[model samples]
Target: MELVDLTTTPAEALPLTAFKAHLRLGSGFADDSLQDDLLAGYLRATLAAIEARTGKVLFERVLQWRLSRWAEAGHQPLPVAPVTAITSVALRNAEGGVSEVAVALYGLERDTHRPRLFAKGATLPAITHDGEAVVSMTAGFGPSWDDIPADLQQAVLLLAAHYYEHRSETNGAVRAMPFGVVSLLESYRNIRVLGARS
Candidate 1:
């Protein structure tokens, strides 16, 4: 299975100003924007790490997931969560032939954690011999930083600040996420039971 990000988060959608404020950096200075890029890098890394740990998308974007076979006959769980829509689905043969699946055949089951693509009928279309199925989707809380849940937004800031403070640390010891950040992300995580499909 392979998952790809089809669209990137726009710079304007990032909470740069808010992050700066959180850091309490001086304003109205000649070199005030000098650390902007560096700070942005930390923010991006923090967002990615939090999303990976929680299996959620912090910003709205398009994604494409490719798989060799369906997880189930009529329903296939999505790898990420808060999916807003299923853009398209297609099957590609080993010989490079592609066939588009009709949108009417399947629908998106919007779930906060384990979203799925479910067939309207008995089962989804089959993939040909040595072929793969590609599912395109849009997933995330929303496009703007303000669209994110308050707890999640606070978590991002906290983690990013941690990264910023440890930017120059040379210690070889590993570090774990702060307890506050972890607590904030706890509810967003997907807890799978034993023998569960997801």
Candidate 2:
């Protein structure tokens, strides 16, 4: 992850005060709801159910919040056209191995899918040992994850934007992002809002 200027964001990107309180409030909403192994099984089952119903992974919708801020700072408005989100990044190890990493955005909504890489619905599939995302093609999602700093978060958005712009529907699978993905990662605006608040 590269460094982005911390001078152009709002006073609070995430409302930690509210978030903590919310977590406390919701802590016991599902007590004993999931046993460890049962929870793991449930996670798998949930992913399967989601894919069977939607044709895409749950992760695509999850990554919208992170990218939206970057979009707001720049000319782009997080939800461009009909694009939903970054989903997760597909990665390739130096050895040529492949895997998928689910991008975690902010809160997710039901009944609607975010426009993102795996929006078409997919099984959780195989994640690499490092938890990088796996795309059908040889896209190197690992590089994005390997060096992901808050700054590089924008690269993910830019890269996704580029993907949507150049997407070809002829194929059933998503394609790799262009090399300029590096440049896209560099677009995070500087934010002085943090210091001002302090």
- The clash numbers for all candidates, in the given order, read 0, 31
Instruction: After the best TM-score superposition of candidate 2, give how far the Cα of residue 125 lies from its true spot, in angstroms.
Output: 27
lDDT of 2 by residue, 120-175 (tens): 23332333343333322111112222323443333334433443444456664434
lDDT of 1 at 116: 92
Model 1: pairs clashing at backbone N, Cα or C within 3 Å: none
Residue runs of model 1 more than 4 Å from their true location after superposition? 172-175, 195-197
TM-score of 2: 0.19
- Assess the local accuracy of residue 41 in candidate 2 as a C-alpha lDDT between 0 and 100: 36
Best by lDDT: 1
lDDT tens digits, residue span 134-181, model 1: 999999999999889999999999999998988878783225789999
Worst 10 residues of 1 by lDDT: 167-176
